[model samples]
Target: MPLPRLARGASGRPAAAPRVRLPREIKVLLAAAFVIALGYGLVAPVLPQFAASFDVGVAAASVIVSVFAFTRLIFAPTSGSLTARLGERKVYVSGVLIVALSTGACAFAQNYWQLLLYRGLGGIGSTMFTVSAMALLVRLAPPDGRGRVSSAYAGTFLMGGILGPVAGGLLAGWGLRVPFLVYAAALVVAAAVVAVMLREPRNAAGGDGTAASPPMTVREALADGTYRASLVSAFANGWATFGVRMSLIPLFAGAVLLAGPSTAGLALAVFAVGNAAALTFSGRLADTLGRKPMVITGLVVTGLALGAVGFTDNVPLFVVLSVVAGFGSGLLNPSQQAAVADVVGNERNGGKVLATFQMATDAGAILGPVLAGALADRLSYGWAFAATGAILLVSALVWLAFGRETLIREPQLQQRPDGTA
Candidate 1:
């Protein structure tokens, strides 16, 4: 679907306010995200346990999780280059296809090593899709519209995350490998949808028309205070939400809460519900409200909620805390993404910037599981959660000290009477 053109003012700037109606390209992308996340969520509850079916310890099982992120972290730079050269649509579809094949292969793996290899290979594809998708979205959205766009994307994934786990828990009863097959099928379908439905919303020729400027270099982006702060925020978000939430929460459920697989899935689903609920509103608010305050508030909330989760033994309390943490995550993520978009602007290629941003998150994800798993093994789950919470607190402190607002404004910084200009 084509997006309506933005009206221009007498001064030749966009005069229209951001609209709530999303463009077709973004809508289709959100659908694809939902399906992909749905499939992954199905597998999330079972992946570690399935790996441990080979008689490995907790740390080794975590290797299966970390290996996927390790590959994504290493390959993200290359994937960004590919997205830049080939355009996002082609790279995005190809990436999904690779992951589909890899996930299908994973279903039949007879040993831990085989599972590790297949999962790790899938990570390369994951990076390709992720970087491309983010680049595409950032490119297409108007400056004022980025927050809502980011939220819509994240919201769709959260919706899938909510539904996939319950279904996965039910399917897990059939076999540990069943969810992998299902996930592979889902990815294939998502790939087909992307291939058929995805188009550059603005230009038929495939450019968004805004990326005409020379692409920003990674070093340049890092120099910006806002982008630097976003990296820290992304790292903490990944460490807690992507890494430990998926890997350790289930283990904690079993060991502490005395819940079974179904309950663990329920906890994950509840968390997604909380995230989804907040995301719909958070994006629009971020667009109007400034990025820094929302992000700072979210970090504090997530940190406190995550820390609380470690101490709760009641299943209801755990689920409630997870939901609260997810809400905080939903609040933080869209704003962080919008801040990056704000810095990169519409004139520069976002591939490298998006890739670097992704790598920061992947760095935390790659390390979190291994470290948390070791910590859990040596000390306790509470300590592991505490460590993850501490990371968020530190991230908040970093933002408070060094972060600058990235939302585009018409006025320059006000000069003070003392000496500052």
Candidate 2:
């Protein structure tokens, strides 16, 4: 007799249907993200300049930027709690709606403080959606495919990131405020699609066959060494990728490399291209080899690349190095996300844990720019870039010392006695 075919799932239940493609819910989530991201991208190029339109000084205008992170930091715990109570679907949709409203309101703000308030409100919504989306993705995906699934999710954001600024620039030609209204509309459309298309997975919705393990607590998750390493890595990822890249790279291109705006733009585009390309393969590598090795390799490569970018004055070389650094980041991200999902491990109430992980990144993004910019002003661009590299290196060291491989292969558990797992 021939052996029976089996399906993969949390309870090892045989699938009723063959899953030749990614799950429908996952596709829906990615679609929603792409649309939302597109709108977000549309607004990114104009936000800072819009804030300055109120006749505020540069420092005051910058407050508009910082307040978003500050609000996200403060609301993270609450966002997690809501996710646990309301479930990811409700929370995700509601959060998107809130963000849409707030972002639209920003277009009408007549003064600097008004813009700041609206932007801050949007931050809270942003956190709500971000944490809930992560919680949903982790819960829905099978353990074996976590890395690839995360890469897909990340890819949607990259698509949005790539297209948004370009679209935003074109919309700016119409009016500075036009993009905000369009972004708000795009967000609404995204929320509606998610509402229509997304149904919670059977496992996550407490279906008939399997009872889930008790959800892990924030305190418990924090005590785990792997989780701690994730936090460290998350912090560094945010610092280097989000914080330093945006705030300092342009200045380095302009002042240090003696490059023009076009060169700076090209450098950013190159980095994004590298990042997108790596996302395609890195996730599969993480699934096959393991999360720890990929993450460590990415960190080391990124650190060395950043350090090298600092010492060189050649613009072309700088662009090349930035692309290399971005590729390293691409390798690191999916693995890091997969590792956290491993620790989360079928828990229902992972919102708080995910929130905490996200908070670490937000905190790094919030702090990195101010500190790095101060260093660049006082010392030099080279020193600032080098210091950022050092932080990433330290984060990698932390992971090396404390992190462990987290991919849980199902076959290993099946090999144990009684088939009772």
Candidate 3:
């Protein structure tokens, strides 16, 4: 069915505000995201801990986390269409409520299956919230400023990476369920912020300035050739960046540096630092350099970093390589998202595109680890890194061979601090 032709996006605007201007609307969005991130992070580290309580091993406990990713993979396609139909204001709020209730239920979970059920439910709601947020950023932020604005949104996850572990560790010590309750409260606060602070009455109208209607479903989203390519690219990127960085690198560290898991953790932290640092500038560069430029650069460099990791026996050398690889990761996300918005066009479709992309994320994570795991069991950790690196390189080649630059309506011009146009 056709979506309602309201002139506005689900964000309740024709498009988001300019990237150059940090408005109250954007702040509310970011603030809510921060709260959500905090709540979510507060429990993340303890997933394994929580599951172990039921006498489940590490692998089964991991399912609690993986189940969420898998569920999100399923929901991603529909999330965009739902946003188009219902509008972000409604979906975002309801998603938070769902997360709250689901997480709260886990507190009462008497068994591993119950915990898995609740976590999976929360995962569904998470897709709704995440997709809605990304969709709104695409709809609300102007074309030229997309890279920059998207950077801010991406930064939230990175920030959460840093803080969530610490918070989760502390809260879990208090009791596993205690963090779940705290997370619930945090979502409520985030929901209230959105309800009260973020409003643009004009955008309530869909394409024709009428009532918002549902946009295309995942079925329609998958039909698009360009969207499919983006998903494939996302899979390649995720598999290489995450699967290896988390699982394979430690083995390499152990082999080369004679260090343990702690060293591998440090290596991962270094990669994140590189990602965070690059994000500070990469977004602006994407605006100036074009989205495709960053995309290609990110892919090529990340692949090279993975390749570099294979050659290194020196710990410091690998650290540098890890940083480079992380920077590559930082560059990949925003540019790809901007490209999705470009191909799909702004409005409710942004939500759907993100959902599809997230599926690729899950696929990469699931498959990457399996592939890496197999390589490790059979050959060596080195082979695993090399294989992922090769895939990264292949991703770049594919993009260069077939990937097209997303059409930007405007050339983002840099302005002098003096305000010279």
Alpha-carbon lDDT of model 2: 0.86
* Candidate with the larger lDDT of 2 and 3: 2
82-173 in candidate 2: lDDT tens per residue?
88777888999999999999999999998888899999999999999999999989988777788888999999999998899989999999
Query: After TM-score superposition, what is the CA distance of residue 403 in candidate 1 from its true location, in Å?
Result: 1.8
Q: Please provide TM-scores, in order, for all candidate models, with all chains considered together.
A: 0.82, 0.90, 0.86
- The reply for model 1, stretches above 4 Å from the true place, is 1-18, 45-62, 108-112, 169-182, 200-211, 251-266, 312-317, 372-383, 409-421
Report the Cα lDDT for candidate 1.
0.85
- State which candidate, 1 or 2, has the greater lDDT: 2
What does the lDDT read for residue 275 in candidate 2?
Answer: 89
lDDT of 1 by residue, 129-243 (tens): 9999998888777777888899988888877877788899999999999999999998999989889988743333325555345566888988888789989989998899988
lDDT of 3 by residue, 1-421 (tens): 2222223335453333244886677778877887787777788877778888999998898889889877877877677677766777778888888999999888889999999999999988988888787777766776667788778877877797688778888878788899899888888888888988876323435548687644546567666544666777789887988666776788778876788888788889999898998889887776655666688788888988987787788888988999999999898878877777766555444565577777787789778988887987898767878888888878777766656666444323557799987
The runs of at least 3 residues in candidate 2 whose Cα sits more than 4 Å from the true structure, single-residue gaps closed, are 1-20, 201-205, 208-214, 412-421
Q: Which whole-number lDDT from 0 to 100 does residue 359 have in model 2? A: 94
- In order of listing, the candidates' clash counts read 0, 0, 17
